[model samples]
Each structure stands twice: as C-alpha cells, then as structure tokens.
Target: MSKIESIDAKAVKTYARTEQTVSDVRSYRLARVIEQLKISNCPAILLYDPVNIRYATDTSNMQIWTVRNPSRYVMVFADGTVISWELHSCEHVWDGVDLDLELRSAVSWIFFSAGHEVESRCATWGAEIVNVMRDRVPGESRLAVDRLDPMGTSYLASKGITLLDGQAMMEMARLIKSPEEIVLMNESLRAAEKGIERMRREMRSGITEQELWANLHYENIKHGGEWIETRLLASGDRTNPWMHECSSRVLQKGDLLAFDTDMIGPNGYCSDISRTWTVDETKPTDEQRRLYSTAFEQVHFNMDLLRPGMSFSEYSEKSWKIPDLYLKNRYSCIAHGIGMVDEYPSISHQVDWTTAGYDGVFRSGMTLCVESYIGAEGGTQGVKLEQQVVLTDDGCVPLTSTEFEMDWL
Candidate 1:
C-alpha cells in the first residue's frame, strides 16, 4: 500500500482563485440551467430555492435563514437574463460585490407586517413574474418554479401561467459540473481538509465530542467557509447505528471518533468527507482494526468501480456486496452525487436498489461521494469512511486527498 497524499490548503486556495474567475463559474452554471430550460421547453424559471438562486446569480446572503423565511429569490429567463429579489434593504448584502444580474426588493411588506394576506403577497410576486415573462418571453410563455408556497402556486395558476418542475430542471442542469465548478469544489475540499487537520491535532481523550467538533468549525470559518451542513460526529459506542450527531459525550482513551463533515465551504460547494479516528495515543484493538480496515477497503473498492458512461442500474448490480452480517446497518447508498451536498443519482447496493435507488448514467464531470460504514447490529463501535471524486473521461479523480488513519489498520 502506498502512502496517501494530502492536500495543501493554502496552495489549493491560492490556485483556485488565481486559475478561474468566480464570475465565469457563475456564468457557466447559469448557462447550464438555460440549456436545461430549453430542453424542458420552459421559457423561464422562478427560483425560490436558495441553492438554485446561488447557482443562478452567484450570490447569497443568509442562505440558511432564507430557506424558511422566503425573504429572497431569483428569476432566470430563457434568454439568460436574471432578476434577483432581496428583502428590503437586504440588497446591501452584496454592496461591493461584482455580479451580473438585475436586483430588486421583493414585494413582501404585506406578508411581513400584517401576516394575514399571504395570498396578496403571492399575487404581487406572481404579477411581477408575469410582467417579466410578457416582456422577455413573448407569446405563450410558460414559467417553471423549483418550489413555491401554496398561495404562490395558486396565484400563478390564476394568472394562466404554466408551471413546470423547476427543481427537476435544476437537478438535470447541475448533474454534470463545468470545469470552473470543479475548481470551486476543489477549493471547498481543501478548506474542509484544513478543518479536518485542526480536529485531528486537537483530538484527545477526556475532551467532549462537541469540543472536538468546534475545532473543525473554527478552522473552516477562519478560512472563509460558509456553513456546516450537519453535526454528525460521534465517539465510542455512539459510532454504531450511525446518524449520531455530535454530543457533549466525553471521549475515552480507546474510543473511536467518527465524523462526517457535511459542510458548505467557499463558493457554496460541499466537501463531504468522513473519517474515524482513535482518540488515544495507544493502538486500536484487533476488533477496531478489523472494522476500520473493512470500511476503508469498502470505500476504496467502490471508488475504484466508478467510471464514466456507466449506467446507474448496471453499477448498482455490479458493485461490491456487503457481508450479510453487516447489511442491516449498512448505509443507505454505496455512493451519492455531491455538489451542493448529496445532490442526485444515488447508487445503492444491489440488494437495496429496487426500493431505494434511481437510474441514470454516470457522465464525465460528475462529482460523487463514495460512502462506507462497517458495524454490526449490536456492535459497540463502527468505522465510517468516504471519498469524494470526480468522474473523468476514462475514470475518476479523487477530490479529497486526506489519508486514511493507517494506524487503525
């Protein structure tokens, strides 16, 4: 076995910014959306989803907050014109930033102050969208919306505008990443690696799992990361049965600490990497070695099986089989597409695919996260391993370069 090479955060960050213009990446993404709209025969898109808004406008302010608040949104026309709406005075969030889109304050005073005329607010927004469509799309135009409140949907239907599933269109557009998007993802991965390095250095027995988790957050934010997607960190017995979020549980000497960094870093790309580390300076037990080694092998084995032009169904059928004993606690999917985070086209194990999977072909430029978790139903501990990679013309290239903990093996 060869030594795994790790990424140099500073170098990657420097190269990402210098090698590509952020505006160009934004344009590339928007162009993809436009292409998808044409294919779907939709003339325009009403993007209320913050992720889709960021994808179209290349700007975000209070993304997580806006997820439920409905304070901001964007509209993209088939001709590639973008109209961005922000809450009153919130438009200043992008004060000095350079962007290529029209900006406006969303009409939401009624909904915000009175809190009763939700339909009125939706009507006003729908009217504004109709006006854009009439001016930009000409005759018999249809509008696509990724998601909308019921009132908004009703308002659009009353206005006689056809609504298509904009979410599906956006997903199709985002399936294959552009070169610049890949660059931004690499930057995100490096930033995540920096966070992992901090966590590893601060790992020690007696420290609370939450305390160790903070180290990763500190490093990520210090380097301009946006937000962590989840708090799935656990130690010792908490590692089994999975999905255990970070708690105040103190680490023991021989405990295994497993974490999944479901984070959105620079440029809003996700860097999802999982690792299980031993807390003490002492060696892992024989059983610990077996679990970790099995997980590590499973992750790499599936990663190796990835290639361009493979049908999802075919891949699912041919992928490695989990031993029957470990199948009960196995992860939902052998791998999943990663872009903004767990995007699309999940490749489940053969035994699990019929009920849990979807079919699509793997194309060059698609980014994927290969996942593995090894633990028995009543096991005391488990190992979680994942690798992020980009599908190339002939094979896949790893985006995450952090070395697995060789000591555990």
Candidate 2:
C-alpha cells in the first residue's frame, strides 16, 4: 500500500472577468467603505488586515505573512481618498490593477523587522498616519481601525487620534455583495470544487490524511486560488470531535474522512464548504451511514430556513433542532456570512443563542454557510457537513457543486 496509484488533477475553469467588470467591482467596494465611514462619522479607516486591504484596494501582497507582521496598510477617507503604504519599495504590486491610490513606503514597526528601534519606528509610522488624519479629516480626530497593537494605539492616541470599531464597520460594509463580486465569487467556488474533486479522486486506503490534504492545496493554487485557511481534515475516530486538523495518519478502508475547505480562492473570496466521505469509497457500516445522514439533514434543514429580511434570532429559533445526544458536539455556528472571508452575522444554534447570538437581518446578495456536526459525546466516529449559498429574496442558492455521498447512506 506504500505505492499509491497516480492521480491527475482535473482542469478547473473559472470565469474570465473583463477589465470593465474588474473596474466595476473595485469602485463598488471602495464606495461601500466610504459609505460605512460616513455612516460611522469617521473621516477615514485604517486597515491592517490584508483581506480588508484587498477589499478596499484590489492589491494582494503577503496575505498570510502580513497577518502576523503588519508590513502593509491602507487608509481610506470618507471622501474615497486611498493612501496605501506598501512594504518597502514593493508598491509596484499594484501596477496594472484598476485602482487609484497614493502609495508610500511602509514603516515596518514589528520587532522582527525593526528590532530595538521599534519606538523610533513607531514615531515615524505615527507621524505619517497623523498627517493623513490631519489632512483628510479636518476638525475630526476619529479614525476606524480594523486591527492595531497597544503600542500603535497608544502612540496614535497621544497624538490626538480617536480609534473607532473599524472591524464592525467593515463587516457591515462587506455583508452584502455587488453584482460583479458574485461573478468573481463563482470563479472562486469553481476552483474550490475542482480541488475537492481531486481530493475525492485521490481518496483511497493507505493514503495519509496529510497527503490527501496536499492535493487540495495543489489544485487550489494551480487553479488561481490564494490559500486555504485551515487543514480541517480528519479520519475515522478523529472525526467525531470535529475541528481536528489533517495529520500523517494513513487512511483505512471504511473510515470516514471529514474536512472543511475554508479556502481563500480566486479574487480573495472564500468558498467555505465541508463534507465527510468514506475512505476507499467502501460501503460504510450502518453507524457511519446514520451519522452522515443526520449531518446531511441538519445542513439542508437550516439552509432552507434562510431568507432575506429574517432576523438572526428568528433564524436560530427556526434552525434544525439538534438531537439532545449530539448537542454538545454540534458545530458552533448554524450559519455565518461569507465574503472575502467569513464576514458578519454568525447565526447561532437555538440553545447557544443567548450568549453567542446578536441581532441582524438576512439581506439579499449575502453569502452564507450552513454547518453541521453529528456525533454523540463519546461516539466512535462522526460526520461533518456544510453548504455555502447565496441568500436572495426568494431563498438560498448553493454555491459549491461538490456532491455529497448520498449513495453511502
């Protein structure tokens, strides 16, 4: 079993967006940010999260690396003025992108880059940011910020800057999608489905979980995806508890392999789909069949409950009622908004609504994921299933084309 059969990845075709479509989406995203900024009465927004930066300006640098190291950032004024501080002289990354922004050299302030000069570096960074605040926001000291460390916050505060909740503002802005965004999202989901298909074709006894997971990564990148957010692939006994990441354990016949593809695909949009399949495509035991059927029921049941204008609480109340035996191991969220990443309004389960729930309306053009995890507290194996969809005035329409294992049941 050491020598696995060779597998070829299927070619993934995505929509070829025209220059006009790209320009339209960029303008729409910027307008949404400006609308949020004006609504919050903040003159500008300070973006550190690469995803948010990409939303504001269609430029992507070191996304995962920049998360830990704030190497780049952007400031979007309520008037739609964009000041982007790129890493060093790498401003050329935005060369042909249909966007207009004042590019400047980023002042690297993290200790890994600046070392002992972090304090002085903060002085340099704070000065530039302060100038923007003063110039763009006259008679206004408030600026929305998605993320910033205490040192940066203190320095900016010392310079008469007031920070608002930019994450909340941005979430509200990105909650609803524009027409052009949906086209790009279709392309992302298409690439993700191709990756899932490759994973399915390569699924077999003796294949390590890690090895199988790499196929997904390979297909994603080969087909224009950006990156996967996690390695949530587990097999057999590991599947019951859920949230277990993929590892080196080899697959065996009749084992259940569950995974959540939280992929950042083409155009930085996410295609968060989850599924559970049997290793070697073997006939599952009765218990495995039961587990998968229950999870499948939960996913679609909740998905059918979604509609535009429904409140989160109402949705939670009407969501699938997880049986008492599996309540403890249920997926944390019944549904959540999805866009460039998992965006606003996480709809909670009925029992968990009190603490984790908030109020929000389901709006047209909002993408969401219906999640399920079915397993008793000490069960031998579990099943996890999820579906990504677009919420419209009539109902929800699924985005992922990856098939479920209905025959196994």
Candidate 3:
C-alpha cells in the first residue's frame, strides 16, 4: 500500500493539522481562480492536474489525477461554495477537513456508459460532470478545464465545451508561499539535509554517480519525503562540462562533484538544494579551491541581495564580476523563480539584465533557489552551489541550513 493508503482516517486528519493543511492553502487558490472566472464570466473551472486538484480540494485521489483515469472533478461557484466528486479510490480525502464542510450530493458520480474501463470512465465522467455543471449554472456558462489530454479534449469538443489556458493564472495564484506551506517546505528541507548527510558519510572513491543518486533518492523517501526529483551527481571532469544530464560515471580522487535534489513535503510542497563536494583526501588544487570558493560566494551574494521591491535583474548586476573574474564565465544572469519547478521565470541574460520586466521584481512571500556554476580552466570541469530561500521584507530566509563547504563530509 502507498503512504497515503497507510494513513488511517483519523491519522490523516491529524497529520494535515501538524503542518499546513491543504484546505487552507487551496482555499486561497480557489478564491483567486473564482475571481478570475467571474471576470472571464466562466461559470465553472475543471481542474485535472494532481497539483491543481490538491490545491483545490486537498485530496490525493490518483484515480482522478492522470490524463487516462480521472476520478473526480471540482467545481467552484460564484457564491464561494465548492462542489467536488467523491470517489472510493480516494482512501479518505475528507479525513482532514472540518466536519462542517459536508460533501455535496449533487457533486457525486455522474453516470456514463456501462462496461467502461477506468480511463474511459474518467473521461466520460469528466464530460458528464461538466455538462451537469453547465446545466445548473446560468445560460452558456463557459467551461474552463485546467489541463486535458488529447483524447479528453476531443471528447469535450464533441459536447461543444470550450477549452482555455489557465497556466499563467494558476501559477500566479500559487507563487506566494503561505505560513503553512513554508512549514512543510522546511520539513522537506530537513529531510534533504538528512539524506545529503547520509550520502556524505557513505561516499567512497569508487562510488558511481548512479550509485550516489540511488543512495540519496532512497534515503529521502525513507525519511518522509514521499516524492523526490531525479538525483543529479556529476563527478570529476564530467562536472565541468555538461553539468546537468545525470550520468553513470564513477567517482575518482580529486573529483569535484556537483548535485541538486528536491524533497517532496506534505501536500506536494517541495524543498530543493544543491551542493559541490570533493572526493578523496588529497589537498585541493589552487584552481579547484578558487573555483569552489567563487561558487560559494556567488550563492551567498545573491541571497544577501534579496528583498521586496528589488528588481531581479538589478540584483544580477551585483554578481556579474564573480563569473567574469573567477570562472571566466561571462554569461551573467539573474536567478530564477522556484516553486513547483526548479526553473520558473528563468534568469535574465546580461544583455537584458538591466531591463525591468523580464527579471521580475522580488517580493515578500516568494521562494527562490540561487545556483552558481563554474567550469574548469577551459570550461572542462565545473562546480555548483545552490540553496532555497524565502524572500522577507528585510532580505531572505535560507530554507536548508547546510554549509557551502562540501568537505564537511
């Protein structure tokens, strides 16, 4: 059974309260989406993404998440009441909510053709629910589905349902972090810290990147991070050039390792961090030491510069010298916005670094990950240091408490 399935109904309710409850975070999201819907005059919004569904109803019913087997759908009315389909597949979706928030009978299973498979039932159910929702709402209520597979799209079109792009609006809604989200993210950070520490203790000269990946990945899940992004470990000279693209290369003496991993927290909130470490006990080369120091300084410099109202591009200018002077890397840029993904609103190039719009201004309540990469003398070997931070009115708050010096191992 899955971690969610193992959760007793009572335990699930208490677990939600232990951190940020999904209802709190998602209620705000729903409010914003509903406001937009009113502006667009879109009567009902169909959410299909797991993240979206979690944001809307705090439920983890996978039967309704995939493009193939959607189990449930959520409908938010202009009056603020939300109706959602209840599915048996969801072990106990309502285990956490206040008892007062009763399930609406009208939102229950909408009948479709019999003898249908799981995926077919999901698609058919989605269409029928939307049709029922349309009939209940005023005349010509524009139906907006968050995300739909091609087959689902064709099915909707057959019924004359209009499709819309809600990515920007949804992303904008989730950009800010709530106190509860911050708590869960912090929990994830702790798990990441523990996993990295484990890697440090077990690492050896012959350890391969793939092996290290498995070590950190498994440890994270064992430590309460239910979902983890791919582990990236590039060692030796491989670290300098194609810094990304996880490889199966083995570790070697004097190899500099660079990596970044994300730990999934409660309710899908995430925490990501990166570090550079060296293998073997030999004294580091002067060049290697200098490059590592530069990367560390860059991460600190960017973190210190964060604050509300500061344009992201303006901050990039402050660290332009590090790349040019230390790494001989002239491509200086602003840091990216990070939340659901590592790259959101990717950094601005030096050419446009001074521009205002591209490098969005920093604001309180936003989370960002600052990473610095440096290649060996001829762009042959590279090193990177990254950390998660939450913007505060004064500056920024570091999510992971790890140090830059990877030698702590």
Candidate 4:
C-alpha cells in the first residue's frame, strides 16, 4: 500500500519531474473549475498574482496583465473562452513561457496605466479585471474570482458582475489534492526535512542567527529547493515573542534559537516548518526543559485531535488552552492549516469560526502545521515545535519523519 492512501506515491514520483507545461495545466485546471461550477458554457477568468495566474492560465509568464487608467480599463482574456484581452507591454515580455501565438493574440484589451503610454501612471488592475468580468459574463453566467480588494468588489457590483466568492470555490479546488499536486508537496516536505536536519547539525554555540538562516537556505537550495517564502531566525529574547521577528543576534550558550521557514518546491507548491534549539554545552536549565516539554505535548495533542467532520474552533478551543492549564504558560493559540502561505484554513478557532472569513470543518485531504511555543522571563528565549500533517480518513499523517526534538550541539 502507498504511504498516501488515495494515490500511488511511487507512480507520482515518476511523473513529478516532466517539466509541467503551463498551458496544459491551465487548460486542465480550468476544465476542473468549469465542472465544479456546473457551467455548460465557457467562462473567462482574470488572473493577476503569480499564484492565481499559475492556478488559472497554467502559464507563469509575468507579462500577461492589463491595467486600468483614465476611465478606460483593459482586460487580458488570454482566450476567447473567457472574452477578455491579453495585456501587452510588460517589463519582461521575453521571459514568457513558450505558449501558442494564437493563444497570445487572443488577448483582447491592453489598457495602459495612467502615464506609462502617455505621464504619471497608476493603475488598479484588479478592479479593471473585475469590471471587465462583470461586463462580459452574462448576468446568468456565474462568475468566480479568487479574491478582490474592496474597490474591485465595488467596481464589479457597479458593472453587474455576479460575484461568486472565489476563495470558497478555489479553496475547495485547492483543498483536494490532485495526483500531480501531492507529489510536488511531498517533494517540498522532503526538502524541508533536509533543511531542518542541516539546521540541527549547524546549531552550535557562537553561531549568529543570520548565519543559521544562510546555512538552512543553502541546504534547501542545494537539494533542489525552488524558492523561500520566508527566512526567519531568532534567538533568546526574540523567541519568547511568539511571532518573533528574525534578527541578527548571535547564538550563545543557554540561548534558545528558534527558526521558521517556508519555501516553494520545484513544482511551485509550498512547504512550511518550524523548530527551536537550545545552545547549552551541557544539560538545559530546568525552565528550558519545562517549556520544551509543554510545547511538545501541545504539538502532539493537536495532532491527535485532528480528523474529518470536526469543527476547527471546537477542537482548537479544546486544545489551545492546554498550555495554560497544564504547563501554566499563557500564550497565543497554537497550530493552523498550512498551504501556500504561513497560515491558512483547515485549522482555526471558534472565534475564527464565528468571526467570519475563516470558519470551516476539518476534512480529509487538507494539510496543516501543528505549532506551539513557550516563552519565559517576561518574553525572551522560548521553546517551540511545529510539524506538518495531512488529514486522512482514519486520522492524520505526518509529512516529515523526524520527531520534534532539539539538537543541542
């Protein structure tokens, strides 16, 4: 049986590196979206960010964009199927992936920013895209968008574009794993593990936090890592601050060094992990040991609580207070779902559930990172643990093999 139940891990590994074609991926993905929407006719999607662009068009070409200025807006349809135009005149038009010329020419409008083609140029491109989508898609045709700024939403409303919250639809689409996506995510997990191990080995006395970050990044890159989302390395006082911002402080004896990083794999999927270490030459202090154990317990506790059909807030409240009750340490909530960013859905609190924007039930095929940290001494050196897990029918499966333990070198 494969480690991942739904798909064959080995077979996925074989096709993982065929050099994905953006057009093919986009075409397939758009088909999937169309099927999900149950729309018989074709509908156009306007993409702006690289992430959304990658999701929609399957092309990572940065040039496919349009701007709105001087009361006239342009839309880059990329395909008549959506009825928009392709924006021309991007900074790196040459860098576009080799796509069909006909497909490129099908782009409709190329509205320029205020002054680019003419003086002082400023453009709210997303608003223009929404407006165009509203104008083109018939009132009966359901239009979907990933996210829209308030201004963009208002413009869509004015243009009569029926806004079907894109996040909800896209979240459903992204939550379930495709064969290709799973393999890429697995590759990202492997790279993160390698980076973690390298950091463990290099965590020694006298090492600067910046140096540790550099070492980890180098290792991740050396092992086919594609791009780093964040390079955070903090020590001592910084660690206790929960979301401790990374600094240039040097590690020393008794310093608890905490590092958190997330990166995109070769396939453009995301991998996020965090760990903390103490630089003591000998045994750690009593306080340090206590804090570490508290964090470890919570990390495992949250993992055990994860499953299908459970409410994120219900489970979160149940487990979030563990630190305060058991360890007598008060801190922010630990653990959250992980995907393309530092924090995401599939894991959230009751407040999040009721507070709007992020309340949802835990389901199979979602990925999350169970995280916990314990601070000491008015907010200084703290112990932390973070592990990535995927929701399964039975329970959850961890992506990385190594346990959350500090390497006191």
Of models 1 and 3, which has the larger TM-score?
1
Clashing pairs in 1: none
| Overall lDDT per candidate, in order of appearance | 0.82, 0.86, 0.63, 0.57
Query: Which whole-number lDDT from 0 to 100 does residue 339 have in model 3?
Result: 60
* lDDT of each residue in 199-247, candidate 4, tens digit only: 7778787777777777667766787665676656778777766665556
- The C-alpha TM-scores of every prediction are 0.93, 0.95, 0.77, 0.74
What is the per-residue lDDT of model 3 for residues 87-157, given as tens digits with 9 covering 90 to 100?
Answer: 55453676765322335322222234234364565465656665666666746636777766575667676
Per-residue lDDT for 1-409 in model 1, tens only? 1111122323333444643467777677888999998898888888988888888777787889888777787888778877878877877766654555688888753455438876666677779888877887778558889978777777778888888999989988888876667778888888899999989899999899999999888877887889998999999999998999999999999898899999899888999999988897558889989998899889877878888778999888888788877889998898898998678878878887778878889887788899999998898898899888877764667787788988766
Best by TM-score: 2
Off by over 4 Å in 2: 1-16
| Per-model root-mean-square deviation over C-alphas | 4.0, 6.8, 7.7, 5.8
Model 2 per-residue lDDT tens digits across residues 283-339: 888988888889998888888888778899999998889998899998989988899
Question: By descending TM-score, how would the candidates be arranged?
Answer: 2, 1, 3, 4
Who wins the lDDT comparison?
2
Per-residue lDDT of 280 in model 3: 67
For lDDT, candidate 1 versus 4, the one ahead is 1
